[model samples]
Target: MDWVFLSELAINGALTGLLYSLFAIGLVLIYKASSVPNLAQGGLTMVGAYVVLALSHDAGLPLWLAIPLAAVIMFGLGFGIERVALRRLAGRPVIMILMLTLGLDIFLRGTTLAIWGGTSRSIELGVSYEPLFLGDLFISRIHLVGAGVAVALFVAFMLFFRTRTGIKLRAIADDYMASWSVGISVEHGVGLSWALASVVAVATGVIWGEIQGVDQALSLLLLKGLTVAVLGGLDSILGAIVAGIILGVIENVGAEFLDPLVGGGSRELIVAAVLILTVMIRPHGLFGRHDIERV
Candidate 1:
């Protein structure tokens, strides 16, 4: 084990971690505001990536314009999903809502496959930037930019949580009836949450697509995002971010160090093991609140 190899591995892990954090945060936002585990988040991310690719490659739009347009489309899709699929399920059983989201996930996957035709596409953002070389480690300019974007979004979310709208959303999450009594429109809050989640999804999609090209299989890759959310605590934004970073680091480290010993594909096994351990230790997740039943 060369020291230089270890250092490079660490840098790679950090980059991957930041990307995971971006994806996980969206899941946390949706869960926190709506109390529904949105299994369709990954599908939306795939759609965003494809939208950017189509706009940039097929329509000849610049990456800058295409990215924002993709986000806007995803926002509309999120709002529509909430309005059409989730709104009617208000006050319904949790299982029912979960199943509805599952259905929505299938629909989104089918829609993406139909539109994109199962082909993979790449985004050439023309970001001709060099890597920062640090002795034995190298970090790409694009990854640094992506990490900066993730950090900025995370900070922005933290700041937004202090605003009046954020307070109303939190109130609804805490007690929907109480929030409604205080004149907060629960439906509107949930819709806003979905919209915000969609924006996050788009951002994540763009970043990840830059790392790994956009493909119809992108929706299936959401299992990684789901794992992050579950391990971090479904309702904790900070927890989700932290958990995502940790998961990314672990996956990279496992692949780098243990893949030879485990005969390849050990990273996924490591993730599953970590998830199982976390669930056993803290079923509510790292930041989730434990429920207490009254007699």
Candidate 2:
């Protein structure tokens, strides 16, 4: 009944949605460039968080130094994956490529578990965990910083797409042979995309780990990100951003008011139901492009 309470929830949902946006954007970037569904995004994200954790906690590196180091490592990891696993498999069946990525994801998850074990560890991000109070409204600094960082990253991506190299990448995505004929290196473009996506994953992981700590279960969030990607469309960057925010708001609002009526856990159901309905109604998603081929 209180409007202020409702407003608070809305703000919270929107900011949290920005975090989801970061995840979804990483996905969209890969899908758009490679036409390969990268199931390894979550693993890449988890690696980023753990890298920071080790550097800051075990090795005693400052947060400032750890961030860029993590980013570079992640980028190299991504580029290597593309160069080694994906490059040889190009022009293969789409289903096979999908399977390869799924396999890669599983391998990464298993390797991560073997190396790090199942124990969860908290990392220091220098942000206070104490909740802020404002005349009956409560906010967390994590939400504010996460949202700001996400938006800043999104802006950076937008600007990157305006550059000359960005245009070439887009062109390659449109038609590979044409771009190749025009002197664009398909391998380089795809490799760069994977690298960029990995960087985004690292950033998202760091933000999320700061908020919720490092754990193996974090990779499960890839499912939620996939849902957001489906709602936004597989190839739509802008759609991913919008759909992430929408998902956050819907999930939060439903959880706040509808959970009691349903005996809880409606958040997952809401997202799943939206995905199902979207598939039945608009399979390509809100901003997805439809392709028509004439015989």
Candidate that would win on TM-score: 2
Which tens-of-lDDT digit does each residue in 1-295 have in candidate 2?
6988887887788788778888888888888777776888888888888888878788889999988898998889888988998888766777887888888878888888898888988777888988878778787888888888878877887778779987777776677778878898888888899999989988888889887778887787788888788888877877777888888888888798889999999988988887898889988888876776789
Query: What TM-score number comes out for model 1?
Result: 0.93
lDDT score for residue 177 of model 1: 79
Off by over 4 Å in 2: 133-136, 292-295
Lowest summed-lDDT stretch of 10 residues in model 2? 168-177
Cα RMSD for predicted model 2: 1.7
- Rate residue 116 of model 2 by lDDT: 85
Q: In candidate 1, what are the lDDT values of residues 1-295, reduced to their tens digit? A: 8878776777777777777778878887888787878888888788788888888888999888988898888888788877887788876777898898788778878988898787677777665567788775887777777777777888888888889998788777777778778898888888888899989888888877877788766676567777778887888777777787788778887788788887899888877887788879888888776676889
Q: Return the TM-score for each candidate structure.
A: 0.93, 0.94
Give the distance in Å from residue 198's predicted Cα in candidate 1 to where it truly belongs.
0.8
Whole-model lDDT, model 2: 0.83
Q: State the number of backbone clashes in model 1.
A: 0
lDDT of each: 0.80, 0.83
